[model samples]
Target: MERIRRLLQRKTLYEPLEGGSESPDGEPIPHSKQQPFSWLDYSVFLLLGVAMLWAWNMFLAAGPYFQRRFESDDRLLRNFQSAELSVSTVGNLGSMILLTKLQARASYPKRIVASLVLNIVVFTLLAVSTRLFLGVTASVYFAFLMLVVFSASLATGLCQNGVFAFVSGFGREEYTQGIMTGQGVAGVLPCIAQIVSVLSVPEKKSEQGAPLESSTSAFAYFLTASVVSTVTLAAFAFLLSRHSPRQRIKRSLDSEDSENDPERFVRKSVPLVRLLKKLFWLAGAVFLTFAVTMMFPVFTQQIQSVRDPHSAPRLFQPASFIPFAFLLWNIGDLIGRVSPAIPGLTLTSKPRLLFILSISRVIFIPMYLLCNLRGKGATISSDVFYLLVVQLLFGLSNGYIGSNCMMGFVEWVDEDEREAAGGFMSLCLVAGLTVGSFLSFFAAGSS
Candidate 1:
């Protein structure tokens, strides 16, 4: 038992957490007194980069195909399927939260490494298999595809949760923003890939009445994704090996820690009731954001449907909004992430204020819808401009809202239940996203 405890208690990373005696202003430090991974930690950052690479390629390969394939489907089906996929992925987030909470208690690096490796393998398999088998139209193939998506979602959720947990243990609050930024960067690659596909014309049909077919360009996308994943896994393996050089926390220090310390324990365990309340509020915010953003997909689909009635539909590149608009949002978020240092930025600390501001777009969404419906009065450019402004505002609000979400829950809950609180909040956010997509499908049909 002593030997096992000693093995688990080793500290592998973080310079900032160890050097600072006082808490860094604004950054929440975990009770374990562990700091989050620092930028200096090459392995964590490298892993983040590799993950981002894989993420971008996977999106490139899969998103265009899915968008094109489903363009003509009933709005409700499109919405429902998208929501279902979102829900499955979000639900996996709950599992991730649980795992992180366990990691906090155990502090086992081996377990974390094993989980991460498994996630990579599972995700790679899903991406490769789904892309390759896409030509098969049988029910069996369809079921298999769905299964693969489910597995992919699980893998992604697991990876996200594990990273969050692992980073938190070291007291790294920046991990969240860093991860989000990585996601934003990864998005850029897919956008470029989609544009390239759009620019490439199909070969001219011969006079022999042969059907002109689109090349499987997306396969190159997925194949690139698989290679990125392979490289990421290799990097992770190397980083884990380097991890051993860092000093391990002595076993005596870990075993002595427990819930008996009232101040510490209370700080750690947030009440479940409080956590749920936070979820309801955050869910409402997410619902509002998703409701408006879901319009992007719907609008793209609508435009394509109108333009290509008889023509076999190809993927539309509205993913331009993802990299562009989402980049704007993330930049705002990055500002918020660093805002704790600025005196003025700290003024907007009220939970309700942030939440309301975040969801303010619910009012604007109706107007965008109204304009979109009044088609003859407004030019397409005018309508699109209006829509873009609304989205930008939405992104800005989200910048504040997403950060508030983490802060608000922390304020609401006592410290101990932080994991459960965060998990529940994530679950609600995901649910709202799923519901929003589902609603948008029907709403598009009506429009």
Candidate 2:
């Protein structure tokens, strides 16, 4: 009973050690001071987030290329390609949930290193699978492809949880912001790579009589992804090395056993159920935000052209709109993620207002559905300018609102709870991605 009382007392008196403080043992406790924000911190967090999600974005960005690989008439293949993220998101969701429940001694840096190695292996295998199965039956090809995607998704889930958890340990919200910004870059970079790949391919006739297979470009992209994974692996190792004082402090703090720390006792005293309840609103807001935004990529690829393919500018041609829309969305998302840094613009202090704004995004669904994409005649969907505007809005809102919710959730929790909170937020975000991906099937059906 005395132990319980002490724990409760600690909980009640708990405050982050931003400055020096005395522990119950009458010893001075050093504050876990965060290093002043520097370009190195920004680069690490941003690149880490980007590296974690880059493969997933490549899967989505390569949809047009995948469509061209299969029989031209196979709408099912197109749908599957479009929904690949949802499929992997299932794996992602599962991994995060398991991480939340499991207690292991593995540190975030180790987890990240393992996840990066796994990603490199998975991406390399994915490239090989595409090449090896190119001549095989479609059934065999897609089966192998899906397996690879699931593996990548599972790796992504682990990496994302680790990255977020790792960054939260810094006790700075900007680290989280940098991760979100990196994710935006993840989405944009693949599209840019795809564009460059498409533009670089020499116009040549293939023996199969269709233009040269897009698989060539895809192979190069995956290979590039693998190389990037290696670079990230190196960067993380360097960052976590003892030479860096900031990381040394974090490693020491993170390595401390929970039983040895009074702060851990206070964190443990809070009921898990209460913490979850506190996080429910932010999670739901993220779910709805992503659920609506995901449908954009699903329908964008199928839209009928507003003008003749030959008449359009090279960049805005019918063949390019899908990637173009994706690129625009990502660029807007990057902008939105950064926008919160501006004074007077952050919604972190206003959860209810943020919730309302998130919910209001549903209006975009009906508006997008009404567009004349894939319709018999030119309509609002065919208007490149209009579609770009809507996509920009969609991406912007998703980034701004999602970043605010995540940052706020972390800030609301005790430092010890921040890692779990990040994992919980990831759970919600992946759930949203999964739900949205499933809904895209219905959207595809309607189209």
Candidate 3:
């Protein structure tokens, strides 16, 4: 009915929404003056999205740094990413399960705020730890690092569930996509930073025993992440205090949803068990989607350019190749995430197709294996172009398939069940990350 009134009002007052008409739920139609959300709202949520995922994405971008820190222990160096992600996913999964079971629409804002503070404190610790731990053994510092990873995962669980529930309850497709857009930004920035950190290592020193990313650079990078969280937290505090139009309206509507039809909402929600059952397919689809995605980086990080490192330019050397490839993959991801906002590009009413595509991403495993892995010989040699193109398409498909799965859940269940569905889906997504993180050990090992 709300969607209908918006359409009727649009036809009478304005010419028509671009893209002929709104495509479907989760579709990003062009905005006009009449829409409730403004540029300010979009900016806030975009930062929210970035701050929500920044910690882990920072870890992802700083894989080489972690590798360097653990270089003394070959086994630890090989498996630090897997272990860090393992702890993170476990922490995320546990917290999300608890948060989902303890549902209250009013708590969403609180969760986001709390999560932001947690992220800031944890990131600061991470930044400072890089330069400190002077006398500590590498293993002990690695333990501290994993603790940070675990704490960040807890924050991720809270923020992801809160942000999605807020967007879904607010019933705005564009704002959710704004978060998606910020996710693209989140993915890109860390990759760029990784490239910079790797490059900043002086050529002379890099050729020496210290081939790792600079500790100073890593310190600056992690500290910058902490500052980002501080800014996002301040922005959110302002949003709540200012009581913008969007917040005002959302509060009233949320109240109605909670207070007006308490019995109906309870009846609609049933139990968490039953609610999750209804979303088995949705959960499974997201599970498989991210399961495949999480496997990519661990293996791909080992891939080297086929160009002869001795003669090839610095940019093409093994050290630089890793970060540059990550940058390209993330750049492709940004493009793919934004593609759904465009009219013709969005995938709608295509769950089966999306699931099939999700499963099909497994093919990338062999594709990566075929590339010239550093220690492992390559079946596909002298073909850096092949690896680059594969990374691009890999990222594009991951973004497209994952976005459509998230958006189409509204169509998957009853109206009152939408909120519960959001939490369950968030849980499922993190569960996928956990499974994939563990599986990466075997995947990368095989490579």
Candidate 4:
């Protein structure tokens, strides 16, 4: 045990001169000791990232299913859109508030656990609410549903901030990448599950009462999502229990000297104003990245392929295009997130280039709008393949550029500042989501 403890303790290799910290070559070296992370460290970071956002992803992916539940009543359908927007807005608000106000004061692991617990409770309630309130009045049902949506969003915000802070402690670029990759997977898995659930239901002989069928499907989908949330909560708990370099370093440093506190070594409370000024551009990039990307589910689903009157009905119907587009976007996002692992793909060194690419993503909005969906004007093309390709590229750019921006921001600050940086960036991300979700309402109106 003593040998292990000694090995885990970080050792200072060089002492700085009294007058200056610069070396002979005039390069200023960091005074903090560094601990190298192993493969296990990498794996844990990646899994935590995945688990952190899985519930949020599942919630977003279930949009179609939830929307379908009110197909019978046009009034309820219109209200559903408002409710959807509220959920996103409230959720983002919750996350932004938590990260901005409480991140520095709260313990990261405890916050993460709290968020996961909230998710389990909220999801379970969603599942139970669907079953119990299926026959209730529309007003009552929507009210209950909105409460669940708000709760889920709050939990998501808390979890995302906690997860980002937790992983940032490792101070490894790959750990950031792992978390981003997990986020992409979170989007993908839920989409796949939705597709499977949709396919499993038998085709009805008559098209009458489609709304009833949709409601039933919605129940099953929410139930599945709740179960997944439960599993994710369990996995997160297990991962949190394991030892990592960050924990080991803190433990050793705490044992060695109370005056040289490890927690204090890596975290300093900087003025929010100064922090915002330093991170403005990076935060804007993250905001724009998510804003443009959020438009996808909001607008893309409204686009339908120009129907072929002469063709027979297919097994994977054109209606599946919405989910398929979602799937492609997520897969492309995963590919993009993984791309930085390749030495040649890393562009964090070039902030200008990355920022330009991120801003250019606005082009996708117009491209998607002009596609032959439910828009007001002439469409450039009604080709389903064209839309799919566009979605793939959109997802690719979103993941790649978003990851680069996030990782670059982390690297820009001192090791002690990384956790706060993560929180700030998370706040930006939520801001973007909220703004984008609001914009989605306008996009919906235009259609």
Candidate 5:
């Protein structure tokens, strides 16, 4: 009905108001003004596209590559460091979430840019510094890989929250759907990245028929992914600069909004207490869901430990099991994203049940642990199969939980609080990711 009214209003306005439309008063005329596309509207779409692609690229080459490098290869030192990396990466979620909350009360494009740039630079430098200090070599590169995983996890968590907060705007439905869709699509990048990894040129042999060395690892595929990601990031930065609070410098360049009144600079900031009260329930669910989700990483570590003396060596292998598991998980999530029908407009018949079902993952994780720990050899393959089934179901549970919980939270908050809620959501998600990583690595690595 609202959309229909807007359409009708647009049509009526374009029709020239029937030569003297007035509302029962001695007025000359009333004209309908179509709202102009604001910076907020344009930036949301721009960021949505870029963020999805950016996240996709981040995970595409990185997930499988890192899984194999840090978790697959059984280097004692690397294994130990990977566990450390998990804790640091997870712990960083606390800082990342808090910063987002702090930044929520204001919108300054330069500050946003500065924050993002600093976060990325610090993250990258930490990894590079660790690599150089440890003297990275294949023999001990697992140590560097551990640091890289840690840095990437932390950076990705921060970047995700930051990007969404700056980019998502007023209203619940469009914004929440946009996030879910982008994340869903982005989450699939590894499925394709796996295929791309297979296409890299193998090293050619010399006249002596001894093969020359090649620099690319299966994970070096991420270098290409990173380059692609850089392009998306630059585009996002450009769009954001044009449409975000960061547009101050651009305004100086173009001299637009020079006459800006003080009123244009202010937006109401919500209270922290108010925002937390709305999120309290969903926050618990998110925390529990993510904590349980850690079992997959643990399962991945165990699977990579599998060896067969008689099987042929294969290049460009994927964490096929994990991705497949998520594919199933995402399907369930899709179902949750769209709920079932209701009768007679009973408010009680709403889709809140989806959120409840999603919480079942907490129960499922223990079963996964029991299956994996039961054996190896003939038992390992069967254990892996059971783990995959559990993950597929887990994905379904995630879909239901994620679909409604976020939307419900947004509905409960005010317009101002919605922005703060976005930051809180990110914090909770990262905290979960961090915790999951820490527990998984410890369990998987502990013999």
Candidate 6:
């Protein structure tokens, strides 16, 4: 037990520093005198972070299903994704700004709890709407679906901002890394659920051509998401409770932060733009990273498997190929997100290297485009192995560069500044997402 505790307590990679902190005013910042972080605390944070993005992932995983719903209407089905992303991104950005304006109370637990409850509601509505709207016009159904997307988007912004702010308040890079890692896992979960939902539910004949997927599988998918949210909600609620040992330790740190730097608790001009350099190009790096990643679920979903009928596995079939691809990318992303826990992997505080790396990720566009995309005979390679390699590298770079930028920025700032940095970082991230959502329109058109 002692050996395990010692191993888990190892120091995380941070900026090049001499184990000291300095405030903006040049005063030394003291380290926390709180209890040691236990394994349970790490698990709770990771799980809660996973829950934070669960709804969005599930929605993306259900994209093909949504297209199926619009099968009869060629126009709507063709452009449903573009419109859906627009609505969700608009809602996400607007809500994040609103929440930032109202975040003076630092009601982290309440914000997270409310968002989780909202997510459960949104997923439930998605599950029900598929069957309930079978008789309605496709346009009406798409409108209703967009509303659900907006709700989930709103919840996502709230939960993510809350989690980021809460973790940043403590100024612990390990916690931040853990939460980001959990988010990568969040991406992975829906892929598994998607496959399960598709395989478990029986398909029936459509009035038109081929068979259609049943809402039963979708119900199970959303239900699984609801259960995850429920479990994470309970866990977060307990962390806020006074009885939990972990909560007590964290609360002490929070109290100390408040007492030591009362100015941070009060709102002031954040100088968000001024922080561009101090943040070590994290804002721009994150912005570009996600903007490029806009290819995912949009352009990515278009990459059909090139199967060798003579020796292909069932997973390479049309029914399961997309989800399997999603799984591989997310698994690679999870690996990259967790890798920074090791020292020097991200080269903290090195802006030039990070910036170059971020810019270089644009090469993935050609890599993906050159694949047997759209089955349009523009192929550099038709090998499924080649496509898998591209996805793994794509996801790995996304997580590694993004995580390092944020982690490096967090480490470079003082504890007092971290709370502000947190909000700023999240803003940049969402800004990236919003731009990516718009860019995906052009990407889809070109493809």
Compose the digit string of candidate 4's lDDT tens values, residues 1-447.
Answer: 998777655322121111111112222113223446557657655666666667666656555555555555668766686676678576657766656665434456666677767777777777676567567666676777777778777777776777776666655678778888888887888778766665667543222222123545555656665665566666655554453333445545555653564444333565567667777777778888988777887766676555552362432353455666678889999999889978789987776787688799988877876776653433665455545567888999999988887777765665556667777888888888888888877877776
Candidate 3 lDDT, 307-350, residue by residue in tens:
77789888887667776777777777778777777767766466
The per-candidate count of clashes, in order, stands at 19, 0, 0, 1, 6, 0
- Sort by lDDT, best first: what order? 3, 6, 2, 4, 5, 1
Stretches off by above 4 angstroms in model 2 are 1-31, 72-79, 103-106, 130-134, 200-212, 242-272, 378-385
lDDT of each: 0.45, 0.69, 0.71, 0.66, 0.46, 0.71
TM-score of each: 0.65, 0.83, 0.84, 0.82, 0.63, 0.83
Q: How far is candidate 4 from the true structure (C-alpha RMSD, Å)?
A: 7.8
For candidate 5, give the lDDT of residue 93. 77
Query: What shift in Å separates residue 66 of candidate 1 from its native position after superposition?
Result: 4.8
Q: In angstroms, what RMSD does candidate 5 have relative to the true structure?
A: 10.2
Model 3 residue 373 distance off true place after TM-score fit, in angstroms? 1.8
RMSD in Å for all candidates = 9.5, 6.6, 6.5, 7.8, 10.2, 6.6
Runs of candidate 4 with Cα error greater than 4 angstroms are 1-34, 60-73, 203-220, 244-256, 259-267, 307-318, 375-385
Question: Residue-wise lDDT of candidate 2 within 1-447, one digit each (tens)?
Answer: 999999977654233333121222322223344345656767877888888889888776565556556554465554566546666878888887787654233245556777889989988986786677567666566677688888888788878777776666566667678888888888888878766665666544334333343676678778878888899888776665522454345446666553476553232333447667887777778878888777887677765456665776655554455677778888889888888877678888677778788899877766666565764554464465445667788889999998888777865677556666776777778888888888888887887
